[model samples]
Structure formats: structure tokens, C-alpha cells
Target: MPAAIALARQLSDADNKGIRLDSASLTEPGTPAEAFAVQRETLALNGWLTAGYKVAIRPDGSSVSAPMAHITHASTSGTAGFDRPAVDALEVEICFVLGKDLAPRNTPYTRETLLDHVAAIYSGVEFLGHRLDDGSRSPALLFLADRLGNAGYVLGEELPAKVTEPGQTYPLTITINGDAVFEGPGKHPNNDPVAAFLLFANALTEPVAKGRIITTGSLCGAIPTPPRAAIAISGFTTLTVTAASTRED
Candidate 1:
């Protein structure tokens, strides 16, 4: 097997079995580009469908994009359930629902062009996880190859289009299992979540289908949670996830 595919399989198998890859056993990607290729192959190997993307801009202004699987959706019943060792942390975010397909073209898409295709704006929570034992301290390329530590996502209520305006800050409060965890003002790093969406759209080498949802980077940094937790985002929405312990039988 190719190194990339072999790495993908190792990661995928670890995920399925609720185990972590030994740091020493991981095959590091040769380059940043190769890491992304490994990510693509990983998705294919697991037969996971690309539902959307998670976009983030580094402090240096460089952007990163990762594909989100269809399984990312959490139930509206104010709960998101995961198996033990599957989810590591949670991030608050803003999500955009696309109303039209954006196919790859010679002409890049602008913020306005991207917004024109948006059907709605939403409050969102991104689930973070990793298959490697020492993923956080791994090389940048290896981290990228691990899907940027993304495990899943939970979309909250639809917000008025006007609320998504650049620089607008939303007062956010997060509680896990009824205990207040994070309370602060949440805003896009670039002041415009739409612009982040546009960046991801334009950078895509493939077409994005209608109804796909793209989530901007975290409003608050990734926060840790318990196995069975209730996450509430005051003034927006609430979600819950029970990370059931895996059975070794």
C-alpha cells in the first residue's frame, strides 16, 4: 500500500476501534501538500461523504480548510452523542448554509458572490478529536493529515442574516452539564465569518453542493468537556453529547 493510504488506514482503524495511534507508529507526510492528499485518501478509505468544510485562519493570516463528514450533524434535541475516545473538545462557531452550488472556475469567488449563495446563517459548535496519541505535539504536516483534529460538528439555530455582519460580536455563554464553562463575546477572527466562508469556497478544487454548511473557526478556543455533557450556548442554542464507553468484547 502507498504510505499515504497506509497512514489513512491506521488512523481510520484507530478511530473505529476507539483507540489512539501510537506516536511512534504514525507515518508522517513528506510535505504539507502530501498531508492534504493523505486526508483525502483517508476519507475515501472510510467511505465518508464530504458534507462541508471547517475553515480557520491562523494568527499569521494563513488559512486552513478541512472537509467535514455528513455524520457531523448533532440532534436538535439539544444533544450530541459520541462514543468514548471519539471527541476531545468543542468550539463555538458561525456556520453558513449554501443555497447554490459553487463549482470550480477560473474566476475566483468574492465575498459578495459567496454571500449571494448563502441561504442562512447559523450558530454552530465544532467537535475536535485526534487519532494519534501525541497529535497536539506532532509535526504540522502530520496534524494536517489528521484532518486538523476535527471529529464532528453540531449546528445550532438559524440566525438572521443581518447578525452575520462583519465585526458584530455576539454575547456567548457556554455551560457543560449545567455548569457555566465559557462566557464572553464571540466574533469572527477576521471580523467577517462570510469572508472566511468565501475563502474556503474559492480555495476548493471541487464543487460545493447546495445545502452544504461551512463553519468558520472557533469563537472561543476549544474547551474540554466530560463524557456525558450538556453544552448550552445561551441566547443562541444548546446541545448535548454522551460519549459512551467503548466495549472491548
Candidate 2:
């Protein structure tokens, strides 16, 4: 059996059983491409559809991305779908809804052209969770293959098109059950969402469809969160959602 598919079987089992795997026994992906291949297989084995994508930049300026299978809008009330809620932490981020398809091509996409493909920009939060026992301490390639610990996401309101301009920042605050947790500037990594999104889009081996959402890395970093806490993140606009209360033993 191919290593990617073999490893994906174990991952799918772990996720379905609601338990973490012993990472040392699993096949380790040697490169980012190999890791992504495993991710594709895992998604297929688990019967999860790709809802969108998430991109993040390392301190060294290189980029990494993962697929998100579940997404929720703020306007939708309730916490039923957020089964894994940020057991570790949560992050505030800028999310974009694509207006057009970004098909794989011989020529790389330009930043200006990519921006034109964006339909709207929104404020949102990313819920972080992992299926590895070692959690964030797991091997980098293995972690990447596991979809970068992306449990789920909740998107807030749409912002004006002008907010997509470079160097834009929001004076933001985050609260849990009405208590202030993070209060400061909400900025995109390196102050450029387009650059981050473009790198992920162009690297894709498959096409990304219109209306699919893509979120750049966190601006507020990861803040520890309580299970089922009512979270409200406010900035250019306000978004509130209740975290999932149920937790695994």
C-alpha cells in the first residue's frame, strides 16, 4: 500500500474514535508535498469534503497551508457543529471569499490579479485542535499532514472592499463571556493577506472554486480558551459565537 494511504487510514481511525494517535508508530511524511498527499487521502477516507483552505507564514517567511473541512458563519446561531472547539487556543484572522476559480496554470498568478479574484473580506476566528498525542510537539511534517490542527472555523461579517488594501489594521478586542482577553491591534501577518493567499493558491495541484473561503494566519496569535465559553471578537466589525461545550476525556 502507498505510505500516504496507509497513514491516512490510521489518521481516519483516530479521528473517528475521538482519540489521539501514537505518532511514533505512524509513517512520517518526508516533505510538504508528501504531507499534503496524505492530507488528501485522509480527507477522502474520513468522508469529509474540502470546505476551504487556511494559509500561514513561518517566522522564516516561508508559507504552509491546509484544508478545512468544516466552516460556520457567525450569523448562524448555536454551537452544535463545533464538536472540537479550540481545546488548546483560538486565533483572530482575516478570511477571504473567492470570487473566481484559480485553476492550476503554467504561469504563476500575480498579486494584483489574485486580489481581483477576491469576492469579499471578513473577520473571523480559527479553532485549533489536533489528533496527535504529542499535540503541537509532533514532528513538523507529520503535523502538516494532519491538516495543521485545523478543527474548524467561524467567520464574522463582511468588510468593505477597501479594507483589503495593504497596511490596513484594525483596533480589535477579544472577550470570553464578556471578559476582555485580547485587546490591541488586529493585523494580518506581514500586513499582506493577498501575498499569503497567493502563495497557497499558486502552489495548489487542484483548482480552488469560486465562493470557497480562504483564511490567512492569525493576527492575535493563539490565546488559551475555555471550553464552551461565549467568544466575542470585535474590531472593524463584531462577531460572536459560543464554543462547543462537550469535551473528550
Candidate 3:
């Protein structure tokens, strides 16, 4: 087993005290592929079930993905619970819920072909967390190995059919504790958020099951939040999240 995999298992172990690791202690992966392999091993060692994935796009247009475990689902009631206080970065994103299975194909899927599998679109938030002591400074490969700092996700209201059309941009407004913190237009880097879904779909070698949720990258970037903060986004859909202290039980 790779040293990184063992190190990741230790970081993800729920039974262990919240341990922080610097990059030196957990050696970085030599390549992107190696990092992804380490992620698979981490999930296996921790016995985490794949609930879905989170996709992030780089400046050069390449994308990286991390599988979200079942435990990462947060309440839609605008409140989220965390076990680690060190990792509380928040990201507002667009989420897609699949209605049907998209079986793996020999060739890549086109935008339209991929959209046909979607059941609904949602406004959502991704809670960022990582085991690395200095996760913010970690390299892309090391970050990917840590599941791209994804700790959990909160789903908002389902978007209207008209707004779900390809290439349409949605106005976004983010508020923390009733104060507007961010307001802007939101659109996937690919011009269509579903394109990111298709990219993820084509990359998979196995069929994606129905009802699997895929969250596209952040819109207003990752925002910091206070322990008792209440976050809300209004535009395509209204969504809210409240941050709570870490639970020991």
C-alpha cells in the first residue's frame, strides 16, 4: 500500500482524535493519477460509501473530481454540523441530481447526451475540509488526494426547467447572517454546468446510478464562515446553511 493511502486512512478515521498532518508527514503523490488512486484506497480503508462526486475546474480547463461519502450529506434546513473546526471553508455551487443511469461508453459523451440523464438541478453549497494541517498551501496533487477538501454538501431548491437550459447564466447572491457578502452572475466554466457533469460521466468506466448527486465547482469561491453563521443564496433558487460547533457524539 502507498504511504499516502495509509496516512489518508488515519486522517479520515472517525474514531481517532482530530489529527492534523503537514505535507512533509503525508508525502504528496507523484502524479494526478497516483493521487486519485490514493483517494480510492482512502475511501476503502475508511469504509465510506460513494454518495456522489464534486468536480472542480482548473484555469487551463482540466477538471479534478472527488467522491463524496454518504456521511457528507448535510441537512437542507440551513444548518450543518461539523466534527472538525479547522476545516470550515464554504463554497456555493450548482448541483445536478441524476434521474437515470448513464452507462459507461467507449467514447466520450456529448453535452446533450449527458443532459438527458439529469432529473433536476439545484442550488447548493459544498463545505470544505481536509486532514492536512496546511491544506490551503497543499499542491494540486496532494489536495486531490485529500478529496479536494470536501467535507459535506447541502442541496437547495430545484431549479425551474427553463433556467436549466444549457448556456444560461443565473444571478447569484450570498448572504451570511442576513448580510449580503457576495453577489454576481454564476455559470460553469464550461459555459454549461451540465458539461462538467458530462466530463465526469465520460471519465467513469462504470455506470452512474440514478439519484446520484454531482456538485459543480464553486461560484463565489470558498468563503470563510463563523461557527454560528447562517448562509443564504438567492437567485435561481433560494438556499440556506447554518454552521454549528463540532459534535463529539
Q: Report the C-alpha displacement of residue 118, candidate 3, in angstroms.
A: 1.1
Per-residue C-alpha lDDT of model 2 across residues 112-142, encoded as one tens digit per residue: 7788888888877888777788866899899
TM-score of each: 0.88, 0.89, 0.84
What's the lDDT for candidate 1?
0.74
Model 3 ranges with Cα > 4 A deviation: 13-19, 59-61, 70-86, 164-167, 245-249
Lowest summed lDDT across 10 adjacent residues in model 3 is found at 78-87
Tens digits of per-residue lDDT for model 1, 97-208: 8899978778888777778888888777877777777756777778788888778776666778887778887788888878888887876677887766776677677788
Candidate 3 lDDT, tens digit per residue, 1-249?
A: 557667567656621343456777667788877888877887888677777889766667676788876333445554444444434578777788889987889877887778788898777777776667666578778888888877767776666656546677778888988888888887655666665676778778677789888887777778876656777777766766666534222
Name the weakest run of 10 consecutive residues (lDDT summed) in model 2.
Answer: 77-86
The backbone clash count of each candidate, in order, is 4, 0, 1
lDDT of 2: 0.78
